[model samples]
Target: MNCLRSILAAGLASLVLFPAPVRAQKTGEAPGVQGSKNIRSMKEIRDEGVVKQRWDVSCGAAALSTLLTYDFKDDTPETSIVVWLLHRVDAKRVRSRGGFSLLDLKHFSEARGYHAEAFSGMSIEDLALEKTSVIVPIREKGFDHFVVVKGFVAGHVILGDPGFGNVTMRVDRFQTLWKDGIVFVVHPPDDRMIGEKRLPVAARLVPDESLISRKIGVTAPSNYLY
Candidate 1:
């Protein structure tokens, strides 16, 4: 009995002297599992202009509305865009086309008095030079969808997704999902220019244009001219 008691005492002393190391919990990790430190959160893409798509097939219209409302301060309604495009083509044809096309967005933007242009083979680095937010089509779940590229935050692409609200994606992931590296760039309407130049929505979110530029290895434009 004394020997058994001695063994127990020694074991308790050893435990007190050398407690097992406790693993530190990582940020964004589940209870005991180590999780990705790169976990991202959805932040408001714009202070006053994120427009969610009211219908499953209206992502293009909603994305256009978001860009016009936020970047150009146009306050265009998604329904107006939808109505305008539907009048140009049959509703059944739009449904058959899978959704509103980038061409439709271009036409609507022009109708609203914004200068819209489409470019292919534009890299994310190219996007860093843009002075305004752009609309990009990406393949999501085997379907083509439109999302507004607000700007780069750190190494992630900030997006104003009409269907999913504001979101961000890693650059590599965005590249993988981006369709043909196509970008739709829009300039503010000529008639309603703001007297004072304002920062782009992404710049407002990060507030450090130099930092974003440095992080992305490209110089961003000084201001998103209205």
Candidate 2:
């Protein structure tokens, strides 16, 4: 009996000294709060395509940079745009007058071989049909700012804001802030050759002078904004 008690005690002591290993969480199992947080972070990163503005008055440049980089894949830095615009216009004047204008952005786009147009009195519904992204100026909290309107997603207007990384707004709220309904649309040079036959190297090298005379028309909007 004493020998039996000694064996039982040794077994209990071994158990106390060495507990069984715990099972690790499986890869297929739900990650709970951490997984949800990771998903939200990914969504934010996917939505933000625009480069954030470095200065307060650089939103216009930043917006244009976003379009060039994100839409056309130009990858032009925002500072390059600011420097280019400031070279043409007085830097102090720009700062005092509240930054660059739509006309300035239009000229910049043209210089980059892109056709740009500004239309007033356009509605959100009209914007919904645009094939490419557009830059819009809005008044919020008594301040004028520029943002790249990516498009509608699930009933919210997705914007690639220069000041803010990415933002979403309701249709009604966006309309109120949009006020004059001004929109600036930029068309890449390649868009003009959608269905056309390939041109000879010499012909392609020559700029399309006819583009200057091309009439601007609105077409059906597409689901993809950029």
Candidate 3:
């Protein structure tokens, strides 16, 4: 690792001194659920600026779910973003709980999370310290909204590795971000039981013998941006 870093450092140093023309790489982001509720569907039709965003949380609380999306005017490989999540829940409105997160994808394009140490490639930690950005404070207006900042790999997972089997399924937990670490939560989105089938309980919340989150399911397209 040291040798690789030294070699990269030397090359970058030479780039500074020589300032030669550099070819650009392909543009891509990672595979992520939409992060907006206003969006009617998650089909890959066009890159219109009007597309709303929502996120597919694995486990939700109080019978609720959320999705988020972002429209790019000039979001090439050079662009980065930071998002903040604000969680908002209402006792009266048992449905449609609210929460939002913030991330920094605009300035800092390379940084590593602690877990990135496992990957053979550059972890979020290996980010160069030339252009460090801050997580802007976007106020929480409704139920949930805040800030989330990730390195270069964030967009990769959201826009890359195209899949066709996107399904809104229940899981033991939906991943979350704390102040400086990652967290797994087992809370079910507030949902009501109906008919012969009851609302399945979430494994993340607790194993209930009676209900589960299998009833409220949404199957989205794998390739959202076609």
Candidate 4:
């Protein structure tokens, strides 16, 4: 559906072309603790009343995905996420209110929100973007995002209108070859587009941060509101 594609596009457009347009209440750049960006691996991010769950990424049933999962690791029990729009969005046909959907993956709080399709303002092809950042509750006290580099070996899902058919839930990580300091979860290594850029993406990382905490069931028609 275009909703997923649009959401996906706004997410990985490009830092240079699409800087933070407007501050999406639920997403923003994370500030370092005491003014420090140096965070060690497996360090404390956030905890919400439990012990470590899994051992390794391979051990967990969850497969490697580029739809980077963010485990909330904030000092306060309450975590927040600030999602900045990376591109102009205006597919108001069938999205939630105001083209913003920010919800807590863990508990079903009254705050569960959505953005309308027409609210985004710009089409998927347009380069309008917003920088969204959110702080949440993870055993670790920082933002643990799951990034996957996607590779299309044999098939593809194209976006509609602005594009068509799309990989609704395939891309796991993002690899930015055109420039540096760009971050987005790309598709698998087999994707044909990866070759176009021919960038070297990291093969493996530590374990699954999502597994470290309780797997909060998240399903919303990929990107459409029920």
Overall lDDT per candidate, in order of appearance = 0.61, 0.60, 0.18, 0.19
| Poorest stretch of ten by lDDT in candidate 1 | 1-10
Q: Write the per-residue lDDT of candidate 1 for residues 32-139, one digit (tens) a residue.
A: 786755322113322335687776677778888987876777788999999999899678766655567777778888887777888888898898877777888776
Better of 2 and 3 by TM-score: 2
State every prediction's TM-score relative to the real structure.
0.65, 0.66, 0.16, 0.18
Name the regions of candidate 1 deviating beyond 4 angstroms.
1-48, 191-226
Q: Tell me how many residue pairs clash in candidate 3.
A: 95
Question: Considering lDDT, where higher is better, how would the candidates rank from best to worst?
Answer: 1, 2, 4, 3
lDDT measured at residue 221 in model 1 versus the true structure, 0 to 100: 16
Residue pairs in candidate 2 whose N, alpha carbon or C atoms collide under 3 angstroms: 129-221
Better of 3 and 4 by TM-score: 4
Report the Cα lDDT for candidate 2. Answer: 0.60
lDDT by residue for model 2 (1-226), tens: 0000001222322222112232334344364633312222322442356677777667778889988887777788989988887789887667555677777778788998888888888998888888767888776444566778877754557766665455556678788878488888988899743232211112111111111111211121111111
Model 4 lDDT at residue 179: 14
List, residue by residue over 4-97, the lDDT tens digit for candidate 4: 1112233232212212122123334466634334432221211111122121111000111111221112121111211112122333411322
Instruction: Identify the superior model by lDDT, candidate 1 or candidate 2.
Output: 1
Query: Per-prediction RMSD in angstroms?
Result: 19.2, 23.5, 23.2, 19.3
Model 2 poorest ten-residue lDDT run: 1-10
In angstroms, the error of model 2 at 132 is 0.9
How well is each residue in 1-226 modelled by candidate 3, as lDDT tens digits? 0000001222322221112222333345446843333322223211111112223221111011111111111232211111211222222222222211111111122121111011112223432221211121111111121121211221211111011111111111111211122211111122221112111111111111112211222321111110
Cα deviation at 197, candidate 2, in Å, is: 24
Task: Please list the residue runs of candidate 3 whose C-alpha ends up more than 4 Å from where it truly belongs after superposition.
Answer: 1-42, 45-155, 159-179, 185-226
